[model samples]
Target: MKNFPLLIILISLCIACKNAKVIIDDPINFNDQRKNLTLAYLKNRYGIEKDDPTIDPRMIVLHWTVIPTYKKSFEAFDNPTLPDWRPDIKNISGLNVSSQFMVDQNGTIYRLLPETIMARHVIGLNHCAIGIENVGGTKNLPLTKAQLKSNIWLVRYLKEKYEINYLIGHYEYTLFENHPLWLEKDDGYRTKKTDPGTDFMKRVRKAVKDLNFKALPKN
Candidate 1:
């Protein structure tokens, strides 16, 4: 306890320096171990019957946390229980639910959880969706270009790794509401959400078009 102040100072410095966009070195090393953990999570929470069978990913869900930093975002996902208002999560892993990756304003991407794991980021599609959360989407701290590039790079990387078909933003998740993408058991129940903004998602979608995850245009 005596070194608490020093510990905090050190932590602050480390955080101040953490950046997710360090050239996005090609072959960012998929971390198969982490990927496997994600896969296990998908099965348990979303009831994805098979992993080896080419799991054709149809959508990529995007999000933005009103929360401020990476550590806080990490802490949010690290736990197994979401906020009480998140009734959508209680029926699933009981974990708070987090995205596979989070991009901070500085363009630093942190792998809070594994992609293979079905996170509770989106409703009705946790099993086959990839969730990417941006650090801040609030009025005080809007999205950044660095974060945009990082997202593009990360999306490209994931597309190369998986057989993903559609890329989606959290806001658009509801548009597909009552649609066939609701293959997961949690197809019903819960309210609507719009995250990372429709415009931002459109930009990301354009960047990842090569991956073939684009949804229909907004009406």
Candidate 2:
């Protein structure tokens, strides 16, 4: 009869672990300055005059850090201000580019910021999109299978938690330019992207096909 209680405890633990994915909390700098910059970006770029830097998260944009290593990738986003190397974007705003979650090459998921907080990851859709960045997308350091698995899990997890309706690769953001979700004010302010590759997105989408996320908008 004593063994019966032990079995119940083990079963409960397994169920709890399965429901809670193992995501490490590795936060990036979202201080006062960063918060101000985000609000400014929302007002200037998207015309959203909000009191707080938060979003409803209607979309999830997947990306891969071309930076090669997890450490370098995290460092690139850890700062509150934009790095000088990204002159193309730094001129537009001082808000450093960041994502809500970053997946390591080995499939470890790290949450960088709160899911509802606005991150300066995707253009035009930052106000409603949650970003997921996978480490290592350079020619020499392509995303691994482990990353694909993690991304699938994350997409499913977020969809379950929020009202996520669309899944897209970074390169596909332009298609939403004229869609109601598109919010960038500057017609000239657009950047080309090819992060987290088409193949990676395809695999992840296929894995979560049952979820029936809305299709990408036509360009």
Best by TM-score: 2
CA shift at 114, candidate 1, in angstroms?
2.4
Off by over 4 Å in 1: 1-56, 85-93, 184-188, 210-214, 217-219
lDDT to native, each model: 0.68, 0.92
Residue 109 alpha-carbon offset, candidate 2, angstroms: 0.4
How close is every model to the real structure, measured as TM-score? 0.69, 0.91
> Candidate 2: global Cα-lDDT?
0.92
Report how far residue 54 has shifted in candidate 2, in Å.
0.3
Error of 2 at 94 (Å): 0.8
Candidate 2 ranges beyond 4 A from true positions: 1-20
Candidate 2, 1-219: lDDT as tens digits: 879999999999998787555889999988999999999999999899989999999999999988777899999999999888999998899999999999999999999999999999999999999999999898899999988888998998999999999999999999999899998888899999998898888899899999998888887
How many steric clashes between backbone atoms does each model show? 16, 0
Candidate 1 lDDT: 0.68
